[model samples]
Target: MRGLHIVGGNQLTGTVTAHGAKNAVLPILAATVLCKHSTIVNCPDLSDVAVSCHILQHLGYRVQRQQSTLTIAREEEGCRDVPPEWMRAMRSSILFLGGMLARCGRITLCPPGGCALGGRPIDLHLSALRQMGAVITEEGDTLRCTAPGGLHGAAVQLPYPSVGATENLLIAAAGTPAETKIIGAAAEPEIIDLIAYLQSCGAFIEYQPGGNLLVQGRRELPGCLHRVLPDRIEAATYLAAAAITGGKITVHANPAHLAAPLAVLRRMGCSITAEENAISLAAPERLQGAGSVVTLPYPGFPTDLQAIFMALATAAEGYTTFTETVFPRRWAHVEELRRMGADITVAGSHAVVRGAPLSGAALTCTDLRAGAAVALAALAAEGESTVTAISHIERGYADFVPTLRTLGAEITLTEV
Candidate 1:
């Protein structure tokens, strides 16, 4: 385990470029199993990516990574069963189910695991696969799925627009022999990037205006070079870190992908500038409280950034309410935040945060985003603070401590 020590009350100033999207690259990496050879550019160096690569290599694929680029090629007939240990490392490991089933017509794996934010049921994913002619059976901790008659196009409608389930269906449908139409599909920019990647590989996929995704499956797909989009959640975290410390920071990220967070930050009285491929934020001397925000699907407030935003609210003058409709147990960080003198009350799906002066305190990160929130709050505190369980932070953000240090933040990582 590792921890971060921060000497607070330093105004961060500098420029940092956003890394590639973790959410985007995981599914794309899984999709590579369907291609003969593929190259993914602008990939982030994160623990999750390393885990995804391990799963691919475990299945007999040759994975060569050079900095921000990854090349995957199918070297032999791959195994159908993914190592249970690898599957337990990250939630996105479940994504390989679709790709494995497409290439080998069978897949056996354990339940996927990652940050224990809440009960993220794979019932939606299982139900969608069963609708596409997959026979699924669960025994103890392992799940066995086989499509003997081969996958065919089906009219599948999701109860919710889950990003994982949407990607799984798209990848599974891409190799089927017919057209698959998905309703209530997720409309995230990551999903659009996946669609573009598949389209470039000769898979016909389109998004209709009214929340529909059409996929025309083929027997074979040719590999192509694809670059992932910028991580909006990571960009938003840096912006919030700057605002909490009363700093001005510019991020080299796509403004179009970060409209929601930028809009919310502007509502909190931060000076924001949007350019072609970069966005800048200048904090106010005294930040005003943003009234309330609800975490919704894409184009709405993202659930991933809710924790970081709550950290920013600690510096506000008034109360800020956060309604987390996406995950039931996302407020695990609220208890840890209270250790640093933050006044926060959690009532079921909602939390009311009262702004107050903070002092440094020892804290533990409850999840990935929660670790980021605690780090940002520590940066704004009056004294030194220590944050443990930093491995959760490393799962998403690449070079987190060094990146903050570049922006004039007094933070250091110590292994324990």
Candidate 2:
């Protein structure tokens, strides 16, 4: 296990260029298999994206990674399809099953792995593929999918706008032979990024005036190069960390893209100044507690930032409520934070946090964003802190300890 050794009571102050969206890059990488020609992608160094590339390679795609760039082309022997062993390693591995099944007419995948925040079932993905005329079977831990003669697009209405389900459907629909329309589509920036990549590859897709998407499938996709958008969630985490520790940091990314989280920061009395592509935040010596925050989908307070904001709430002078609507059981980190001297109580999906001075303790990361929250709280705490099982953090955050250390934080990493 790898743990981050953080000496607390230091302010993070520096300029940090945000990386590509871990969420956006994964599904986009899965979409590369739809192309007969090589596809080039410029992305940041994120472990999850790299792991997705490895899964693709195991499926027999010729993949090359140089720094932040990835070039992927079909192998001479074609792909043998992604196996169940590699699929169980990461949640995004499920994404390739749809694309590969649509194009290759067969695919098999195991249940994917990631942080245990809540029950993230792939039933929506399976149902959508079934509606598109695919034969799907479940045998114990493996999912076997076959879409003979390729897939035909069908109208899919997601019970909930799951980002993974939406991307799976979109990628599968892009390679199919019929027109596919998705109702109540997730309008997140990540979804838009995937749509842009599909459009670049000759898929005719349009976002209707209402909340629906229309995709016209094509026979083959052209070789294309694309650059990923900067990670908004990472930007929010850093911004909240700066506010929690009473420091100033300029994030060089699209600031307007962070309106929701930035609004929450401003409400918490953090002084925020913004430019076109960069935003600088300076926390007040004393933070004023914003009473309540409810996490929602796109254009709302993101669930991804709920953990970070909970940490920020700890530095406030009063009480704050963090509510999770997307994942009912996502407050697993509340108990971990309480162990570190934070006054917090978890009630189902909501957490009631009372502002208190936090002291160091040995903490374990319950999930990916939760680990980031742990770091945020530790930076504002009174003494040294050790965060264990940080593989979840490493999956989404690239060079995390170094990034924090560059901002005047005292942190080191040890493998134990």
Candidate 3:
């Protein structure tokens, strides 16, 4: 286990560049399994990506990482069953099912694992696959899927806009025998990026209004290099850290594809400036409270960023309520923040945070983004704060400590 120790009340200053989207990069890597030749991806080196690479390697794919570039090449026959124990470490392991079924017509894997935030059901994933003409059944903890004579795409509608389910359908439909029309699709930037990469692999796809997407399946796909876009969640996390610490910091390589989080921060009295390729944030000397924000799909307040935003709202002038409609249990960090002297209360899917002075205290991270929230809160606290069990944080953020240190934050990490 590893822990981060932070000396609070230090105004973070300097410039930090946002890395590639962890959300986008993971699915893009999973899509590589559909390629016949080696695929090269240039992006940040995050632990989740490393775990995705490990999953690919377990499927007999050879992966080489040089700095930010990852070269993935398949060297063996199709793997029917994905390693079960390996699946426990990463939730994105479920992403392999779609590609494996598309390429080899069958895939067996244990249940995926990630943050225990809520009940993340794969029902949408199985339903969409079945709609695409794949037969699926559960064998204990393992899910076995087979599509003999390849899948034939059809019109499928999701009850909710699930990012993981949408991505799984995209990968499965990319190689099926029939064209797949996905209604009520998840239009998150990561989903769009995955569709774009699928198009690069010779899959035809188009976006319609109201988050509907149509993917055309074909017989063959050719591999190509893909450069993942900057991580909007990571960028928002950094901006929130800046706001919470009353610091002035600039995040380079932030994509304008996301505007909701930036807009919310601007409303919170943070000075936000944007150019063609860069987004900068200068924290106000005194942070003002934002009334309310509801987490929604893309182009709206992102559920992924709600935790970090709560940390920024802690020092506000009044109370702010964050309603997370996407996932009820997403507020795992609320209790952790309360441990650091924050005034917060969670009611069902909503959390009310009253602005207060945060004092340094020991806190434990519950999930990936929750870890980031506590880290941001620690930056603004009055004394020393120790964040224990930071292994979850490393799964997403790339070089978080170094990035914060470069921004003049008094933060250090010790391996246990």
Candidate 4:
């Protein structure tokens, strides 16, 4: 069992560069089966990444990892069906459904699992694949999909913009020699990064108006090298940590990707300076609470940052309200924050937080982002806090503790 121990009241100040986006890396890796070889750079060293590599090896790909770079080459006969354990390891494992289906006309896997966020159904993904001519059968907890005649390009009309569905369809359509139009697709920066990687590997993709994604699989895609985009969530987390501790820090990342978060910080009385490739934030002595914030699809405030912002609200002067639309049950951090002597109330998908003098207490990590939220609270608290279940936090952020230490956080990890 591993846990994080944090001594409170240390203001983090310094510069940090965000690692590659995990959301980008996973789908790109899933899409790699469409190519014969691939070389990816700037990938964060995370536990999920190691699992992805294990999956690649299971698919008969020779994988070589060197720090932040991964080189993959096919060495043996690729396997179409991944084990149930692998699929159950992370929700992202469901992404293999599309890639494997495209690579080998069939695939067998169990329901994917991760941090139980609540009601993350893959109905859109399955329905869209059905629209594209995939015959899927659900047997118990397993899903068996077969595309005997192979998939074709069709208009995938989604009820809402779901990122996983969009990425899965793009990976499937990239291998089907026809045009696939994804209507009402998610427009997250991670989606754009996937399109960039696919384009670099010889797939024809267009980001059209009305949030539609068009993919033309006119030719076979070969492997190509691509450096993933900076992780906006990681960068935003750094900013939130700085704000809660009333510190100043510069984060090297794309400013455009962080527009929504930066705007919220600016509204909270923080001094914000945005450059072409980097953004800096200087928090006030006593931070003022940001007003209401609602999470919507991209170009809006991201749902991923909601927990971190909620943590930030506890350290602010007034009230801050957060409404989570993506995963409404993502209130795992609220109880932990309350244990640390913060004031918070949750009803349905909304949480209202008030600034209170916080004292550290023993806590637990519930999910990835929620784990980060509690850790941020530990930094701003008045004493010491021990947070267990750190494996959740490692699934996404790269060099999380090291990065915090670099920024002068009084934190350490005890691995047992």
Best by lDDT: 1
Clashing pairs in 1: none
Question: lDDT of model 3 at residue 266?
Answer: 82
Could you report the Cα RMSD, in angstroms, for every candidate shown?
0.9, 1.3, 1.3, 1.0
lDDT of 2 by residue, 333-367 (tens): 78778877889888788888888988888898988
Per-residue lDDT tens digits for candidate 4, residues 1-416, read 99999999999999999899999999999888888899999998988888888888898898898989999887875566888888888889888888777778799888888888889999988999988889999999989899888887899898999999989998999888899999999989999999999899888998889889889974357889999999999999999999989999999999999888898898888999999889999999998889999998999999889989888898889999999999998898899999988899899999899989899999999999999999999999999999999999999998899989988899999874
TM-score per prediction, in order, is 0.99, 0.97, 0.97, 0.98
lDDT of candidate model 2 versus the reference: 0.85
Residue 364, candidate 4: how far off, in angstroms? 0.7
lDDT for each of the candidates?
0.91, 0.85, 0.85, 0.90
lDDT by residue for model 3 over 1-416, one digit each (tens)? 78998999889877777788899988888888887654555577877788888888888888988888888877886564778876778888888888888888888888888888798888889988888778998989878789887888789999998999999989888877577889999888889888878888788899888778888877667777777888888887887888888888777765576588887788889988898877888988888778888999887899888888999889777888999988888977988888877899888988898999898898898999899999999999899999988989998998999999988899999765
lDDT, residue 309, candidate 2:
91
Clashes in each model (backbone N, CA, C under 3 Å)?
0, 0, 0, 0
The worst-scoring run of ten residues by lDDT in candidate 1 lies at 73-82
Selected candidate, larger TM-score, 2 vs 4: 4
